[model samples]
Target: PVPVFKSELTGLTLPANAEIIAEGFIDPNELMDEGPFGEYTGYYSGNKGKDYPKPILRVERILHRNNPTMWSTTVGKPINDIHMIQSLNRTATLWHDLETMRVPGIEGVYIPAEACGRFWAVVSVRQKYPGHSNQVGNAVIASTTGHYGVKGVIVVDHDIAADDWDRVWWALSTRFDPKRSAQIIDRGRSTPLDPGLPIEAREITSRIILDACTPFEWTNKPNEIFMNREVLQKVSDRWNDYGFDGASPVANMIDRLVKPEAIKTKKK
Candidate 1:
């Protein structure tokens, strides 16, 4: 269980084991000029290095534990701690929101840290019927976690993981038909810090949703090529016969794609 205590300054419950707490109040009338700080987008967001007026916070009391430690991280560029946190948080939130909305057939969701976490999202869905792929794509944009900041969404088949970039690209190349798959929304809530839009028009932006799943309505669907499961098992069983390092090569994705009866085993 977690420990807690009441703050003398505000009579509010606080974490007793906290390193430090600075009680403060934001005065709406008191404004201060704040500068262009580095943002998660790897660029300065506050008026391109110019100071902007912001509400002022006044600290009235302070509390701390022994050897209190203060933690901080720089928010800039991709593959950083901030980007990773954004990815995990946004991904989980998107999945949760979709689940709460009772959107069916959602398999996976991923917010890539390389896309600044907020700009792009990839989703995997098992299409259930005609227009199911479109439903999922629109649902992503309407989700609580995805309604803001996200500029693009790529919806793929359940066979691919949302985080698998290679398979995602493959699906985009093979399954995506621009005329049918592309959806462009001209109006969206934009973040004020977004550099793509002019400072004056930062309140609105565009969004695009790309559906990469094969149409569920098609009766004569294209047969996907897959390796024979029997052959794969034979190779795994005879790994020692071949000169290779470590255990048999892991092919989790391939294994999932291939069914024993789907393709015939090649004659040895």
Candidate 2:
């Protein structure tokens, strides 16, 4: 027979096992080696060999449906299904935070897959103020959702796609100056999965704010570049009819004039 206990939060008595004895009390000061359990980071570290204090989770009661099925997840590489879900969550949360800031020329937000969904974020915003990119970077780090796992937050001009690594690198190479474009934060609670931290101590992580915006020193730049969508649509409609097969004639002509080889290959 199973005994039941009433929960303070749920206000219900839950069926609990009496004989399958595991006993522990919540001690704010006490710490023990809790797990060598498999973690989402795809590494196992716990009370086995390492001398690290583990926070205790007190289990008050247990409930079971007759013959319940246990479900579990494994985390490792970037392409994992769990990582994809986290990436989507990060994108939505980051986008919402940026929109709340009302930054000018804001285009889109994306957290790339390679960054493990939480360690890094890229934001695309219009450069309105002298240090707009830096402002965005700081705001991203300060955001409640952003505060968790992010070690770097990069802000780029609207011209750069937040999701495209190549374009992001190009912007960094051309627009960023190490002295002017970088901001470093010395201390924050680090992600536990980050192997850089020593197993015995709480990890402190540094955040890098990369301002990938164009130089504000250029006064002749327009505040906004408007695209004539109607004209663009017309060009797209007539692209195949024009001598440019499966390509935009205007784009092809521009490429041909600037660098002829760029237009030689058809886009797959």
List, in order, the clash count of every candidate structure.
0, 1
Q: Write the per-residue lDDT of candidate 1 for residues 44-81, one digit (tens) a residue.
A: 78574344588877989889988889998768878899
Of candidate 1, the 10-residue stretch with the lowest lDDT total is 259-268
Q: How many clashes show up in model 2?
A: 1
Residue 122 of model 2 has an lDDT of 92
TM-score of each: 0.83, 0.64
Model 1 TM-score, all chains together: 0.83
Question: Of the candidates shown, which would achieve the greatest lDDT relative to the real structure?
Answer: 1
For residue 261, model 1's alpha carbon misses the true position, in angstroms, by 8.0
The parts of candidate 2 lying over 4 Å away from their true place are 1-32, 46-70, 220-268
lDDT per residue, candidate 2, 141-260, as tens digits? 888768877889878887667887877897788778899889899887686666556666536788899888886667775443344444665776788877776666565334323322
